[model samples]
Target: MSITFEINRGDLAKAITIALKFAGKERELPMLCGINLSIIKGQLTITGTDRFRLGLVRIRPIPETADGATNPDLDGPGSNIGVLPRATATRLLRVIGGPLDGRSPNVELTSSGRELTVADGETRLTVTLVDEKFPDVVGILLDEMERPIDLDLWGVNTALFAAFKDAAWRKGDHATVRLSTASRPAVVRIGDHFIGCLMPVQIAKRGSTASDWKEFLTSEPERPTRTTKRASRAAK
Candidate 1:
């Protein structure tokens, strides 16, 4: 069976919200490093984790096709969604995050077995799945001890990125910044007021590319915020 779905910016935004969190973990098996998207009982479940934290989001698909006629050029009509490797999937989402007009573009996801491809009009992203089963993330999430605290999502991201970048210049094993939740939410004091959220971390690639790093840094609050002590390793 095949499926053709027209994804709008809102839908794409929500998917990225879920996908980025799942991609922020250390993977014992390389394939577990990607987000898993599966259609179950008429809803789409997106799951991600880095062993310490796990993020699971359920999304309902909007029917973008009519008359049962497959978009032919697009995957035909059905409910078969695909799993995209975290890095590639993250990148794919960024490319489509702009206006839905042709410039920003829409992406088409297709999968068979462990291989997944994300296509944007003429651009294509192909990734080979890591040949290992993702660990049971839900179980780990259930065992966590801390009660979830509410923080300003955008504020926290801005502060974290600034802290991570500032720590990059320091020489040490630990760098810590304590955010006070007394006045306004912690994240807003720093910047990034557009998207408010807490996300998990999954990938560990280093880079100076503005787009890539910016997207990766601010995608989720689930990613561990590294202080000077832990940040030193990444600095070198």
Candidate 2:
């Protein structure tokens, strides 16, 4: 069955976020690498994972009436809305971000011979899915242990990105950012490697309220208590 689905900015953003995180770099099984989109129980679930970090997003669709129902199938608005592999979804999102008729921003999905075609206006991307089964990703997400620390999201994100960018110039595959609570420090690792450290930045203020000023600093490598002169000189 052929159907049309309207894609808004929110949906596009969510799709892109999941796709970027899960798209496979290896060329073995290409189809298992795409984001799977399924509509159920009034919620659209987008899932993507590289067997390490699985990203899932549940989005509510815009209010629209389908032809087959008495009240309305608000949950699954379109028929046969199959999965779009990661590569296809990424390209589709890029096209959607470009110049388009805002009033009629629609993505057409057509499945033929094990391939799915994602089209936005004149641009189209086709992706083939491998027959291999997708692993049970949802269960893993559900089983994650609760984090102990309460994070300052805005502060942490800003500090973390800044720390990563600063560490880019360092010579090595390993780079990390570490943040500490009053009691302990948080560490950031890149690709099974430790790179750098980050400290929480506190803002200072005057008047009736008291405050303190703090900033995240990039430091030299964590040195051994007893280090060779060559290593010490290189760090300096």
TM-score of each: 0.45, 0.48
**Candidate 1 runs further than 4 Å off:** 1-6, 27-32, 66-83, 103-107, 120-123, 137-236
- Candidate 2, superposed: residue stretches over 4 Å from native: 1-5, 28-32, 65-83, 101-103, 106-128, 143-223, 226-236
Cα displacement (Å) at residue 33, model 1: 2.7
Worst 10 residues of 2 by lDDT: 206-215
lDDT of 2 by residue, 32-151 (tens): 577665554555555555543344555554454233223334355532244566656776666656655653454544545456666656667777644555555444332332235543
Per-candidate total of colliding backbone pairs: 26, 10
lDDT, residue 218, model 2: 44
Put down candidate 1 lDDT per residue, 20-111, tens digits, no spaces.
55355454556457776655444555655544334455545444433344433332232334445677666766765666665433455556
Give the best candidate by lDDT.
Answer: 2
